[model samples]
Target: MPYDFNQQIIQEFRANRGKVGGPFEGARLLLLTTTGARSGVRRTVPLGYLNDEGGRMLVIASAGGAPHHPAWYHNLRADPRVTVETGVFTVEAEAAVLEGEERERLFARAVEADSGWADYQARSGRVLPVVALTPRSVSFPDLPEGASPPLHADRLDATLVPATSDDRAAVMAAIRSLLAGAPALGADVTPALAHTGGVPGVWVSAAGGSATGDGVTLYVHGGGFEHTQPALEPLMACRLSEATRRPAFKVEQRLAPVHPYPAALDDVVAVYRSLLEQGVPSDRVIVCGESSGGTLVLSALLALKEAGDPLPGAAVAISPLTDLTLSSRSLDVDDGRDVISRRVAEHVTAQYLAGAPADQAPQSPLHGDLSGLPPLLLVAGTAEVLLDDTRRFAAAASAAGAEVTLDLYEGMPHAFHASVMAQDPPAVAMTFLRRLADWVAGSRARGRRGC
Candidate 1:
């Protein structure tokens, strides 16, 4: 935890001068000065700002990709009254935590200001806190004086569907077909045949690419609980290989409904452990998955931690049905925009759990103790009903001191990343994957140099 002298300049500019030249340009910023929750002393930190149709300043409680909320965030939660300072002037305002539709709307605007926030949301398995700072009476310099602008509720974009069944044959078929297509190998894509022992058809596609360089994404696919073709997730896997230049592996784990719950999770754990045993270092692997595969990623991480295995570098969960209870508000609110409905999620959960409680940790990652897990990346469509699931998961992860990133695309449906081959949004997804791979590659290089 030693400080980097080079990073010190950037941090100093961010904290004191309020005009850091990297990553946050062209956007207005403010210094939120708050008394420390425990220290009882004043602490001031500059934050990226978001304003709705009204000029009210909105700031997310993202502590620069840290594992926990900054001390100032705790102070504000304890006392909502805080002071705001910008490049020119200061003002007094009240902090209001926005949730649900209001929270989502405000969050979208914040993403517009810093698209990288989508990565932060993906890293934290929790909804990044969105707090609006409204001046007591609008006499602030950041906003023109005497402007008591009319305020409107941030509208939830009307593009979510919440009621599709998980058993839709067309959706499942599409997933299978995508998996069946041969990967378009890149120059850096290194490959080796998957050896699954007597399991017959387990394939391992590994790509070693990450923005941080210290992370790798190990993926598992989902087809109900019993049937998933690991080869299907090649679109993402190959992209990782091209991006990180490391290795990205898609472990063909057993599926559910038939293989059910622990069967697939156990297989994933074995694959992760095998990688470490094979000399691939623990800090270099990140587990990733889509749908039930995302669930397997979470479950495997938990089990690994419990079994005293060294945790992987990080993880990514896309449209992960982390909660089997199907109790999130989005199941109803997003019913129209969702490709898979709550009924389907519930049915799949029941079949997977057989007779276990819906809120079991393996069944609902949101309810699990998320402390000590590696950083995570979460991607979901603003229109899909699982939006709430991602939001809630990110917030909880943040509260538990884990770094998380979330990307909520404007109006895509569920598993939209799967359709990247034939869709517009896939370009955005590729951009995200490339960034992720670069980060992981950097992390790996840093780790080797003992950084």
Candidate 2:
């Protein structure tokens, strides 16, 4: 469902009626009044504020740090003349790009305002364009729905891959056996089978193993495209395994910077194919991941469809880095959240996606076709800088006619699932995993009705 945050937020330190809540509470915010590119009217958007060096408000054109620029941002670039409104007062300003030491000093200031911005920058691997809304004067243009975001082909053909009787039996046996064992502490996670043909390097989580039940979920972990392991993700993995009451098999895939790009994607494809060969039905699987892992999940889904493999029933992502372009305006705006910085994330992106084309289907799922993938659940903290990536990706997916569910936890940090050790983590994480388990179980039941 579309978030009604603009109307639902209880607190008020206002900007525009459309201004969604972010992490920086006291930081000064401004409404950029710009003219529409195609239309001849004025449009106002509330954005996060940063005072570079001598208190000059700095706004980076990091449109959720996506590779492409946002429409409003592009409008300003076309006509540098614009107006700025801080609840205090309105002033005319010129939107000029910032670079070099001036850019660095100001970016540092912006990061100080919100750390999550740093994380966005890191994930994007881009210089994160910075702009200054300096005082100026000009007539604003009328803003209309300037243009729509990019669209990739949909991968919902997996609905064609029916669950066979034998596939149902394997899944049921895995789930029952997995449910029979003691759950792994902080590591046991809900597992589901997605495809029937077993892909190489993949194993079906059977019942009565370390974690029990019929196979209910398929889990992939995130490491920023360079450094994560299934062992490291045991906390959420285990939780998800037990919650789904199935064997949750973690893909210990290769990383980037060395292995890079499709190496990880290849492993995912290989594993899914292996499952199908083993008689696991695609409809019974739920593909999932977090951060970089989230990126892999979506990318793998697209690859599967491209290879004519059946798609999974549902998927979940925690702070998934959907946009590799790092061009969203929010990267600089939502900077207060922790656990990552835009600088670090961007660096990882540059290394992992290095040499790979920006529009490559396997490198960035955001650039792939999102239509007909599957039911999707996207969870991210309101404070997270990548929140815009989640926002845009979900919007894009919805626009593409996919069922997308998004939950933005207020004040939660990036990768909140891994931060279960952090003070006051959400009870919803645990609850969500449990719900996922039930959903997988229910889906399995539906497929086995005649069996």
Candidate 3:
């Protein structure tokens, strides 16, 4: 309705080479400069785009479901030629509207990739238009002279090499050392050993003034399931404790390529059961983790449900790896943007699964029955390779009648919340941590009131 907001976004987009702050910071946005149909003056608008099969870039003219078509859409209809800036690269493209089944199919794919499009459509009683922007020519400057760049250059980093078993101990030690002197953020750090349901683990907590009697958080760390980092998990545990004003436990589980498949899962389940047996009411405990640790938290919930065991009050999965199959579009779209890689996924899958089917329940919880699980809060960054995993899982879980809340951070990377202190202004990670704490505390309060 107003050009002022669009103008501000346009300015940020141009200044940042496609990157913009605020809600759209980490989102996939492209600046479309079009020739006005009547005015004939050039007009620019920032829109989200999806990469289609035939190397075509797809943009939805949902206009947040406005009654009339967006001005840019009308401009494109009159003049097919358009200028597109995808943050990373600028290109000349021809836009063509899709109709009938093609439009429906692509729209469905967009909804699957991001449910926000569906929400926009639902809010307005109109058929959203989909336009295909086929590039006239692709350019790549960083590639070797003879090497042709792929259809899309979304990845900003090179492919990573997977770590082997020999690197496990050293990696763990280094992470532990880095987190050894981590600031508690006003909480006191305490180290303790615990045995949950006969499974032993190292328990670290942030207590004292910040501690509350409401409940506790079980913090799981992520290292591709191959190794356990003592420092990182403890640091996260401390943050959780401080944020929630409750004690937090960092459970140490066996690593894969050594214990494999059900080993880590079993250990976490034991810890959960032990918490229940130790007089912690089921509704007072919150289970949470990042990366593979997130996967473990979800899998444990499934395992506990199947076994008729009590469930926790709520769960939080941060940039979790839900699909062992490694089949998410963001994996390709975020290849260079994320630190994790296909090699690491394959390596971790091999080590953890140890010949188990990729879609096996409890191993790949996305394939498991999500019913009966407790309320889930999933946090993921649009820039993460596992973005699709969290999105798909949240969608599936919600469809199964589970209480699921998915928070898509615009531009965060994997485990962005793991750091005790974030360098960015607004400290998005710390904000998320505090949000998690509030959610957990609220859940407990509701339960106590029998709400």
- State TM-scores per candidate: 0.57, 0.55, 0.61
State which candidate, 1 or 2, has the greater lDDT: 1
Task: For candidate 3, write residues 106-175 as lDDT tens digits.
Answer: 9999999899889888877788999999876432222121034333232111111122232333333433
Candidate that scores best on TM-score = 3
lDDT of 3: 0.71
- Expressed as tens digits, the lDDT of each residue in 137-233 for candidate 2 is 2111111111332232231111101112343333334334433442345332333444423332233343334221233356777778788633335
Clashes of each: 77, 103, 5
Q: Please rank every candidate by TM-score, starting with the best.
A: 3, 1, 2
Per-residue accuracy of model 1 over 165-249 as CA lDDT, tens digit each: 3323334455455655744534343333233222322322343343234334576776667565443455556555555455566
| Candidate 2 deviation (Cα RMSD) | 18.1
- Candidate 1 wrongly placed segments (more than 4 Å): 1-216, 229-231, 421-426, 438-451
- With candidate 2 superimposed using the best TM-score fit, by how many Å does residue 344's alpha carbon deviate from the native? 1.2
Estimate candidate 1's RMSD in Å: 16.5
lDDT of 1: 0.61
State the lDDT at 29 in candidate 3: 80
